[model samples]
Target: MTPRHDENTVFMTEQEAERIRNTVKIRLQRCSELAGHARETRDSKDAIRQATGASLMADMGAADPDSAQTKTQRGTLPVIAVGQPYPPCMLPLRDLQPMKLSNLRMDTHHRGRRLAVKRASPVVTLVARSWTMVFDEEEGGEIERLEVCLHKTRHGQDILESASVFVIKEPYFTLTDQGEATLRIDHPSDLVVCQDETANDILASLNEAKDDVDGVTAAAEKFARACKDHGNAALEKQNLPLAHAKYTEGLKVARQNIVSKSNPDLARDLSRNRAHVNLLLNQLDEAKADAKASLTGRQDQRSRELDSKAYFRAGCAAYNLGAYQEAKAFFEEQRKLTPGNEAASAYLRKIETRLHEQENGAFNFQKIRAGLSRSRPRADAASFVGGTEVRESRLPGRGRGRGLFATRDVAAGEVVLCEKAFCVVWGHEMEALTAMTYDVRDGGIRASPVGLTRSVVQKLLGNPSQVKRVMDLYGDYQGGGNDNVPTKMRPAEEEGPVVVDVFRVHGIVSRNAFGPGGDENGVGSSSSASAGLWVRAAYANHSCVPNAEKEYAGDLLVLRATQPIAAGDEILHAYHDGSSGDYSARRRALMTTWGFECDCALCAAEAADDPAVLKRRKELAEEADAFVGREHWAGAKRVAVARAKRLARDIEGTYDGERYEGLPRLAARTILEWLALAGQRR
Candidate 1:
């Protein structure tokens, strides 16, 4: 009987159909020839099985017989009997390809237990001592019985109850000898709850029920109070980020409550509190905005205290922003709200003195500096990493630009310099929105034609002083005409016709901006690696054998000496991952990316072909690989440590100084880990 075709299926012409039939016939003929040869040669069972499988697949129109063997070898297609039906249990599971849960049989010993669940109905039950989630196929066709062992935690309990449908991503699966499959989720994010339309409907209903004016008001108030309490706790602990986050959350909740007509006074209080936190964070503009927002429609006696605090915060922010007249008005209002307030009175007097001085022809620089110093928080002198004094000098033959030099003796592991980024761009959304070409390696915004233009515009809008500092860095753009900057980015009214500031800033950032440093904890992720401009860090020249290393803590970049640096030694740090590759690769990378030929001590030695250096490195790598392949952890550790020490010694010998110190330390730590593992095995 001829099979019927669906309307959606394209009907083939007689010529096309005939050609396909002829091709199939040819394939079948070839399979028959191979089978004949197999029988004539009296091949082994394995060979015969392969030949038979290929023939069967060709006859069934599954694949070309000639390519079947190749596909089977590569595990792309399974080898099965020609006419036999595929077992239901052995069928490829959708979304769970590569590794299926049903494949985890008790008799087989699998090293890795990483499995992705396609679709599952998680039936959670509270067993004695623990909770277990039995994930079954959605259709309940196969009773494979995959059980996920869950620990007793508030979050875990909540998940077990809430997660009915789940897609367990990269879960560790283990099968016992008795064919009992157990899945373990080490991280909460690994298990994704598949919320279908029904789940969304239920959630929507619940949200609607809670959206009543009274209910919303009460919930928002409670949430705001809790967030404010948490913010206060974070402030006490000196976790500025956490405190800011909590205060922001409280403000959001307070705003929501205000929208529901719950309590305007509570919203005002939250705004006032948030303003205080913003002031502490040195976000003067944000503080002033919040303080103004807090006083927007409030004139009640109950809100008098909040008004006083808001006025003071606004005044302080305005004073820092150099809006003396506005600051004076706010301070006067604050003083009036709280009679006999010494702090408010003192600030008012200072504002008057500053106004009077400004009106006169003479300006007292020392007095202004003292007043500014008193307002700003002082950095701990002992905590300073690099000494405050670093000199920049032209180093010929090194590069076209100047290199930073250490003025004083810098000890190993001492921070040479710590400076906050002038401007930083991060996150996928911002990176995509900003017209910038991003580095594929670290996912940092690169200075593309469009991206740099946008960045310069953003910087100019933020602060012209910051833009000037960025422009001061070494840029490839030589003095050019006004056409370099886009017409849209050009300021409407400028003293000079030259709008090359954008081009200059872009070129400078392209050459000098440090790649996003690791997080505060020195742990890096795709999201954390950002591009930032550090004026001081940019001056330190690049080196394959650098004496110092750059560490990132938030927006701040800290340059630390890896080894003891002499008073007059040039402070250098690697611009790339220098420890991974040999000298040749490092030089090529530097030349290609930064437009410079590296002549660092290590690169120089490598170029001259120092006998037994590259050869020894190759041998050590091979030895480590062989040891690891044989599961000889001790041998692997020893070889790795030796390789690390040899590299460090080579660097020290070439430069006559200790460099690549981290390589040896890392190798030693790895050896300790291997020893610990060996102890566990014993």
Candidate 2:
């Protein structure tokens, strides 16, 4: 009897998978033809039009075995695998690849907007993930087979998902199939899925919700005017939550209605206020989204995508979603958008630390609650990252420069790579300088780590001309608590968009932060205690054995993502990596850059490596962390240096390399120790 192709019979593999290491060879030659033809089409909307862009991605897609199909049915895909494809400990993507063969630098500065690429793991590995085609050698003609299994979720949701299939003629190059079959996720509770049908209404509601931006000042004045008469009235006696709700509603109105083309100040304020209100209500994700929206006014194709706010918002959303990987990605994107945004990157690093704590059973709710008072669970300074102040920088996309672009989907644990403007030296001794010359509201001030000049620090001693600079830093010039406005006029309780040659932020501490100070080769200085305080440290992303390391001397922070960063990968340090080295996510993140499969040695070793190895690695990590937690600076530094040396030696291939050991792990250990000490001092 002949067997049917339905669920009745199991599909058996007739031959071993044909692994192809030379995926790009055939496609590379074809790319020349595709590129020439792509130029003739002249359209950005379609993927097939591009010879290299989507064309290359398509070529690679054709080789995969999974057959992604568009199902018309409302059924959802069942859980193919639990959690992630691989466990956090066994992330196959973290393995670092060889140095970039391309000398291309996507200068996003011309775009004047924030841009990011997929950050790669600094650690190199040997195990490889090869794409292979396994087909039946027998069964006469084309045989149908049943293999995949399914399940039903809580709400009687049956996820009938099927995998996609394609011929594996190459490894990385995907050919356009135009059609295929795969699983579908019917996010039953997704906002985009449900409210999309009424986009107009959704937008209208959003607009109405943002009306406060235009009238908030007037409303505040009215409240102030009526205060004398209504001081003892029922409105004054209203509950905190209720009154808070009213202000919250007004704040929301301001965010949606802000116009980037017209009221840049209003738009920024509204967006900022709404996010703050969200925080008051504990709606962290919503607050973050609003913050991100604030930066779009000055964005263009080439510049960092949005202001720092957008990154903070996206990062918060990813964190709340428990998509730490995604959250890290967003933060990396934020860093790329604003290389000076230390607040965002620091928070990104913090989340990594928090997750590490949790995974190691460090979820001490009581301790967390206690710590909450000292440091909020969310990453940031005393105020909501940045108060309502917004600055506008022209986007670079309008010009003819290669813009910095995101290479892959970034997650929170991942670091986003960025380029730093070279430093301008002041004196002749050639002493490496890490100082910020601020044009503060009230005075002339020079901020640096503890080692900087004392005379430079003493410049603010009773100089009459310096008063304005000093006052501006604290948000006042006329001894009044408003923006750098005129002496007689007041701000009416709401701040306006600043336009003075960068006023109100002469606080050398907030501006001109420290550089990450290193590169992909892991050649650089570790952060000094004080230098870590510079806000610029926020922009210096994490990478194991990073080309740059955020150094702290006293109060300065410096950045560096050194040479050897590939054409597509975002240079990064391990996120709060301490005890053991790069976990599973590290290797896979590197894979995200090439837009293909990864069979890095560490990832390949996951199945066979003793689980105890991972457990022991994490245990040692915790022990190492305990050193920093206890303020054992010497021990922490010792551990950090040892970790770096070991990884460096391992990279040189002198020792028996493990599944995961390299610069990434070492950097993670170093940063975690620094952060621990930093947190304790504060």
Candidate 3:
């Protein structure tokens, strides 16, 4: 029998209320899955309704009149959600097998701060840092600790937390030269955290594990050596990618060792080993840089041998780069360090021959280098935009300026372009710009917006042609092309001739740079987000209803078409979040932020003073809302789907072919939610 509530109020046990909450939560989560699987309105609507009903029951504090009796009769407890409440009495570390703790506080030495505990979100630690520590639990509850380096960082961080206890299944273990064993956590999902009844025991276990710092130095040494061995093994197997991965892992481990100051030899060895791998992989510049790094500070017999190898690698990279003289010099140093080295002798001969050929006018060094440069890897458009073929075109009447156009017919959900930013200035990294300044040689007079502008100027100084390209971008400032910046307070630099290229670059950046979405991962800056300049992507004009959408993956921007675009059609992208506000709100944002009034089809129709079209859209919107308010999910879904289709038709019917494409996409999403609710009703 259903429990009765008083006329004035209802009383319920906390446990019963919790059960009801759990049931509601489960139903809601299930609804999300149903929505994902929903294909048609009828089936989806039924699922959505059940989900809605479950929510209403939970909110109203009503018992599942049938569920309670059925559950009691069946002797089954309510379904528990994953990763909630600590489990009772810690399992033996061996029984747990691989111990994985997501979001657990790992003791780290960062920036001179010893034993600093920082939250290592899966992505932040694994993907960004590429390695973490693992603890081994013994039979008597004692913990054995080892630092593990990861071969890859492609794991997701959505469910990984620092305070959660994770049970690692089927762990892979490797022993270093120092005989310390380290466990690897490769898959993000491999770490499972279950609800615990004795949370204090688990906390104690974790504390014991962290406090057992004996043999940490030896363990770290072993782990770092193991990483290098793994890399070398991968190299021997001719798996360059795996070798690179291992080497990278090893480098991270070596750098993090607290005893690193006492072990300069190991650090030098790690760098040299990675440099050798990079050379074999044809990464000439990286190889050269690494080889140079290995030679910095301290000299011993082991160091000298490593230095010889470094010189050889550097020579080979320089030879590939067509720097014959530099290559010859490095080869000579290698030959001096290791007498009778045939490879170095051979390389020296080759350099001498190349130089002789150049002197004899039989070879064009510049031409050969240019040809080599052409053979180097070209950046793929898919790297930034995904895979869309768009071309820049002038839009005369719109006052919107240059815009991207479709080169061929593009289907909905097609990736149009993937592009890396030409230059990115992260909000937090802006401080770095402040310290970067150019001063007149004699007077030390600093320019206005000194830091950031100076940094940009220095970058431009490195590449004059890039400066020209930046100059071509639109600048809102009304300064003459050759004008020198005028300084009122400066008798400092004779105030006569200060080049304003820094100011010009600043203006161009202000006008065209995009503030990309998402939190910065401390890769570039401490800021939560960054602003970047994508030279080609800058050509895409803004529209309130855009056909193409931009997504940021780190520094890369991906552009995907939301609707089918025919050949020669102008490609449009949204500059702001399109989901918020109505037509007028969108227009205001576009005008204020982008400095343009949108004349897209939706804007035009509203401006045309057509009451019938306006009234119908408003009415359809109201009908959808009314259905939702009444819990009539099926009706709401049907209305939403119809509204989306109608909007699409109106966009297609427009004479100019420009559209407010975001509306239909937003409507489609709403329909999916309604479908989930409707499916629940069934």
Candidate 4:
């Protein structure tokens, strides 16, 4: 049953033995790679042993072997013993759909280590993937309510629908899903099934406002052709904002296409383009998810290339979320995939530098924010970077035109205006509403979203920045010497009201940006609504012609207007899409939505908005097939070097001159080398 080398062949002559030793060295190198990976992952001795055990089980049957050489040969490698499990750098995930993963969002560029108190081992997280409901055969259809690893996949989500419990790193701790994780439903009615129209409305709203929330979010049955056309024309733009608009459309199409898809490949391509849209939109997570999904639905060769991008996206997410270790792993994988990719290398090195700073306790918030603050400064005050009118009322009665929009032309991604944030009360007097109380009946309904709002406010009260902000405002007001204005909010009134600095906020001024951003509004509301709390950021409104965008730099708020503005063009901001799920939903749910009187740019456009435009676009795209074809590149390259004369500041946007200057030279060299090869062939 066993085949073995003869004893005579097992040993060899000295020269032959030398060759054998060289071959053995390669095997040892493989061992080193495996061991090194284990070491790099911060794997415990037990984990390392487990991995090796699994490997040995594959190499030779899972049998006990006393000898070291035999155990290693069979892949049962030994590991350094570890003490107690690394303290759980994990937190309990809230039992909510579209789970909010409890992670420490930090700044790696800051020159200080992120200090955190780790809980004892056995921490748990609710998986984000399991948010999707699963359909069952015997059980009919069911929406699963269970928690798993913080980062489970859709596959995992489906599996969790039926399972009651799960664990991460077995033998440490297990997630008990019996109580709240899995809720049993007696009949199909227990499930929240919606009417066809309601589902359509919800879907439509989500699709339309996916990016720069236009009114396109009203019909779920009909696809939003706006974003689709934008996607098709996205890559054919010289202007970045025009390009951004196209990408934004592509993003909406990609997202809408997902839940209802006939071809996974097309979906994947759309998804890949959507990631680019996310980068443009600054929606990092969605971008990453799209990128990963794209790789899954493509061919192997393309998949590998896309995986490189997926890893790059993961690194970006980890870096943004302050997970240095995870970021490092992702970056390293990217480097391995494309050894000379400048973009990847630049990011990789930056993250490595950040990791060094993090470990050394040098995470500097001001420095990080300062760097984050670095952006193109637009000169115009009448338009946003993409030339949208995104301004609201400025200085109360200075008049609407006195607001954030520009009177001149501005460029892409530029800073427009900056204003310090505060709860300003002129003259330090007048009876300001310190506390406003409202009564609610005991049996009244309290929605989950509202509950979430209340909880978030409670948490914000405990945050240091919020505490400082409140104190600052309190000192500013003086409360007319009434002790009634307590320094610290009562625990019972934690969600009463608070102030914040909003930046580059889209849409209406009442609503707040939440989740990832540091300055989202929560628990702060006033009756009459007075329009609630208006961030100079959110004060802007929707207009067919937007002027400026609200952006933030610490407590400093700025408005960036991109295009030229005449004396009168209703300055407005696009209400953030998905800010309230969708358009009609926003109209029904939100009491007040303002900016345009009614008509917007999208509403008025005739030619571009025409149905013939869609058909013409398809024809034009088809025409391009005949108009364009691939050119050939053969043989070696020897790039030529040259210097160019100085040029005027045309300011259309250039790649720092370095890339432009380098390209022609490189092309010239390559051409010369090819000619030389042709001469040689003669």
Q: Judging by lDDT against the true structure, name the best candidate.
A: 1
Tens-digit per-residue lDDT, 1-682, candidate 1? 1111111112234553344334434544444443312112112344335434543554455533221111111122211111111111111124343445444433232323334343233233321111233423432322233333222122113444454555554444433212223454423333454433332332233357644756555655676677778878987887665676667656655665343266676666666777787677655666787798888435676566678888999999877645678999998898777787898998888787656543431334344234322122121111132443445555446745667787778789876776655555442223211111323233222222223233443444323323344555686664332223332222211211122334345457667765553333222222222466667778888876688998654445668889998878888888874343345555655664476887765565556654565555544444433433445544345554555455444433433224443333221232234445555554
Mark the regions of model 4 whose C-alpha exceeds 4 Å error after superposition.
Answer: 1-229, 232-262, 297-299, 362-682
lDDT on C-alpha atoms for all candidate structures: 0.48, 0.30, 0.47, 0.32
lDDT, candidate 4, at 272: 64
Which stretches in model 2 have alpha-carbon errors above 4 Å? 1-265, 297-306, 354-682
Tens-place lDDT per residue, model 3, 1-682, is: 1111112112234565455455545544544444323112113244335434644554465543323211222122222111111111112233442222221222211111111122221212211112223222322222222222221221122222333344544433332212222333322323333322232332233335455544554555666677678778888997665676566555554554353664666656777887787777655665776687678534677667778889998898777645678889999998888888999998877676666543432333234333322122112112223223444455545865456776667789876665656655454453222111111112111111222333344344322334454566665443443232222212211211123343356556545666555443222221112456776677788765688898765445667789998877887887775432245556665654455677765566456635564445444544444444554455446555565455444433432224443334332234345556666655
User: Which of candidates 1 and 2 reaches a greater lDDT?
Assistant: 1
lDDT of 2 by residue, 572-623 (tens): 3322222125345455433321112333333344435466655555455444
- What is the TM-score of candidate 1? 0.38
TM-scores of the candidates are 0.38, 0.20, 0.35, 0.24
| Candidates by TM-score, descending order | 1, 3, 4, 2
Model 1, CA-based lDDT: 0.48
For residues 600-669, what per-residue lDDT tens digits would candidate 4 score against the true structure?
3332332223455434433432322222222122322222111101011111121124323422221122
TM-score of candidate 3 relative to the true fold: 0.35
